[model samples]
Target: MTAEVCEIVITAPDAEWAADFTRTLVETRLAACGHQTPIRSIYRWDGAVHDNAETRIALHTQLIHADEILRLTNQSHPYKVPCFLVQPILSASPDYGTWIIDCTTRPEAI
Candidate 1:
């Protein structure tokens, strides 16, 4: 069966949390690579509009492993409602794409 590439974006309250979460994900082989960027988010929550600065972690993983990845992320996340957005990769550099697929595949040690 052909493998699919996917990117998932998760937001954390701060950079420290983002780093910790991303490290766990990579160490567990749930993600191939994770990039964290600082961002300012403005949204309504509990009937109040608010603005806050947050860190966003984008995870590169495989489609087949999406559910497990999300499950683990939510379990470890600090927010009551963590943001987990998944996007399919339409196309990518062949070598990098292959690497993403290889990294997310089931490991022999697991």
Candidate 2:
């Protein structure tokens, strides 16, 4: 069975932006919760390899909100190409799955 929830990963240039973005998603009920962590990113950009310190926020919410989350991130993120990865939760405790659904707003309701 397909899971009813998902985890969306987002990376920001700094902690402040990550916090703000996380808050926005939660406040708007797009995400049930966000866990932030500091991470080092090594990537190739513009024909050059770059290493940078970044803040990663993992947002947990209903799978139904993925598209809206993607749209919002693209619209508000500072980076021209922000990191947004949505991965389905293949399995979760029944209680936790229920909590996620309860915490997030249904798209039709907004």
Model 2, residue pairs in steric clash: none
Off by over 4 Å in 1: 1-3
Model 2: lDDT of residue 11: 94
* Cα lDDT listed for each candidate: 0.86, 0.90
Indicate the residue-level lDDT of 2 in model 1: 28
Question: Which 10 consecutive residues of model 2 have the lowest summed lDDT?
Answer: 101-110
lDDT of 1 by residue, 1-110 (tens): 12499899999999998898888878878889999999999988999998999999999988877898789877888888989999998888899898987787777745
Q: Which stretches of candidate 2 lie over 4 Å from their true place?
A: 107-110
The TM-score, computed over Cα atoms with residue i paired to residue i, of candidate 2 is 0.92
Clashing pairs in 1: none
Query: What's the count of clashing pairs in each model shown?
Result: 0, 0
User: How displaced is residue 71 in candidate 2, in Å?
Assistant: 1.0
